[model samples]
Target: MTAVPQPTAALLDGTALARELTARTAESAAELRRRTGTAPCLATVLVGADPASVTYVRMKQNSCAKAGIESRHVALPAEISTAGLVDAVTALSEDPAVHGILLQHPVGAHIDERAAFEAIAPGKDVDGVTTASFAAMSFGLPGFVSCTPGGIMRLLDAYDVELSGRHAVVVGRSPILGKPAGMLLLARDATVTYCHSRTADLRAHLREADLVVAAVGRPRFIRGEDLKPGVVVVDAGYNEGNVGDVDFDSAAARASLITPVPGGVGPMTIAVLLEQTVEAAWRQLVS
Candidate 1:
């Protein structure tokens, strides 16, 4: 009879860490208000009526309120042209009162997503969707990072997960999450591999990973059989009802450390967004 593998890695509790970060952000926001006589502000743009997108944007706004930051929401019709979306984002980018801008992704198939993302200025791109933000993240520079990836790193740090010289395999290559996530891990000295829709034999890669990040949107994309024993797993994908890309039940059994979907990466994303908004406000005041 085969013995079950015992988890050597502990669960990465993103919820607790996010709470700490939120407290810090709230304090920073208060300080910024004192110093600049203005609270930090975040502008969220939602095109059309994607239920998930609306929920996410609302979550962000609620988090901002908790952190004592102001939120401005922009809602556009689904049939709005690409140019119209770009114009909206650009207007938010230029708004002096708005320190951070979040353009909810998957705006619409008819709209040009890249153009809309690029319309956000690098400094104000708190959601970190702009090309400039991606370049900065890839280069390991001081800039706003994509919320999900940034949150994952924070969770790893909070848990003291060693990234240096470790094998980190990211299962996805979406510009917002997977691709930049791998780059961030690489910057920390992890030997990172990126697997996407085109990757052949994903299980082979997962077997070699010391750290695995499941960012693909498909639920239960990475199974327990694919993971190496004691591997650290960061599940960043959020489907309906806070489901992740990983098969949590199976992956948790194999993983030494893992992040739960709803309470895991989700809260941290909003925490990072609020924290970066305060940082942006500080930068704006200094300039």
Candidate 2:
């Protein structure tokens, strides 16, 4: 009888780590409320009623509740002008009661999303979508980080991944996810290579990477055969039917460590958002 192949990689187990982090955030939130009598509040602004975006916002709000944080939501029409959206976010940013501001992405193709993000006060930019936040991430300043990338860092740390001097390949260039992720890796002294749809001979890059961050957004875009043996894989994509950018089944056979699609990066993203919101509140209320 033929023996079934076993997965060689250790699971990153983001769900378990997120739970621990969220519990600690809850303790921090409780302490803040006890000391300042103010609950950490996050204001979430959704431009359109895109089902996925709405669902993501709801998930973050639910996480806030679990972490003892307050949440305020604003749902705007799909056709709202960029200026109008900016005004909405600016109002939230200026409000003392709102500790953090989250403007959901893909805010209508016509609207200037960057303008709206800039409207958020740098102090209250807990979602970390603003240029100021990106600069902070690149420079390692004392500021909030892009939630998913922050979570990815936390995941790597939890697994004791040695990043310094490693050849890291990031397969995406989205400003929020891919770019900042690479910048953070570079800040840690990793040699980073970026790949996208137009990149030539992508497989050559993957084979040289000690760590691979798959944020390309395409389901199963990175095949197992293309990866180096014992490479660490972080699948940051969340496609339909709980798929990820990397082919998990095949990649697990060769990876040293890998994150699962649903229980991996997804949970950690919200966890980091909640933690940052609470931190923003503490800084605002106490300092």
Name the best candidate (by TM-score): 2
> Which residue window of length 10 is worst by lDDT in model 1?
2-11
TM-score of each: 0.95, 0.97
Output the lDDT of residue 51, model 1: 81
RMSD list, candidates in order: 1.9, 1.4
Clashes found in each candidate (C-alpha, N, C closer than 3 A): 1, 0
Q: Which pairs in model 2 have colliding backbones?
A: none
Reference-based lDDT, residue 87, model 2: 88
The digit string of per-residue lDDT tens for model 2 on 122-241 reads 999897889999998899889989999999999999999999999999999998899999999999999999999999999999999899999998999998888989999999999998
Task: Give the Cα lDDT of each candidate.
Answer: 0.89, 0.93
Candidate 2 displacement at residue 202 in angstroms: 0.6
Worst 10 residues of 2 by lDDT: 2-11
Q: List the residue pairs that clash in candidate 1.
A: 9-256
